[model samples]
Target: MIDIVTVDTPHPYPPRISAFTRPFWEALAEGRLLTTRSVATRALTFPPKPISPADWTTEVEWVELSGSGVLYSHTTIHAAPTAFVGDLPYRVAIIDLDEGIRLATRHIGEIAPVIGAPVDLVAVRHTDAVSFAARSRA
Candidate 1:
């Protein structure tokens, strides 16, 4: 198994915050993860949509995520983007959350990333922001 890695660095860019997405960023700053569930169809979504993507008529309600998931896929990056050159050979992963939403995130854990490995969401605190990373449950 390859050793997973972690990095502590300042987030380079600020996200565009719309009124609908503000709550999501606010929750991240406080080390909490939130998603939206459709008021009509009861489907869960990440990034906190103001309305359900499934059915436009449905308004959504904010819900907290347990930060648990399984690693669906991943890749190791060696090509350096100007902003992330310092963090070469980083692993980015797609996770399938227990809540049924899928999100792409950095993989951070002692165990190597393998397809179907159980993982937990972890908050990566930057200088003035927070992002998510996934840790292997094993």
Candidate 2:
């Protein structure tokens, strides 16, 4: 199990959660990643949409992800926008979740990111809410 570290410095921007996205947020708070899947098309939608974003169908079900994936791409930003300047040298990446849904999230851990490297999801606790990051698997 990954430890969800609570940062003294809260995130400047937190997502606005709604009923449609509540399951996802609740699971993340428990260190589990949950999303919605389209029952008809097997398409996955992150952020737990009420309807299938791919087919606009109302037949959606909650699914838990394995939380293992590969880093498709990543880059470190030395210069961030004004709202994020305090957190300098932060890294972000596009991850190919094993379930076939791709998500963009922050990167954590000391390991240098490499393309195709295996990763696992980690929950980071902030003052306002919980967030996720991809940690490199050595």
For model 2, the superposed segments whose C-alpha errors exceed 4 Å read: 1-3
Please give, for residues 1-138, the per-residue lDDT of candidate 1 as tens digits.
112233466776546778888887777666678889888888887767877888874578988888888999999999967877777778999999888889998787678998998888876667656666888877
RMSD of each: 4.3, 1.6
Candidate 1 global CA lDDT score: 0.78
* Runs in model 1 lying further than 4 Å from the true structure: 1-8
Worst 10-residue lDDT window for candidate 1 reads 1-10
> What does the lDDT come to for candidate 2?
0.86
Candidate 1 local lDDT, residue 51: 73
Against the true structure, whose TM-score is highest? 2
What lDDT tens digits, residue by residue, belong to model 2 across residues 15-129?
7888788888888888788888899998998767889989999999998898899999999989988878888889999999888889999898899899999999888888877
Residue 70 lDDT, candidate 2, scale 0-100: 99
Model 2: which residue pairs collide? none
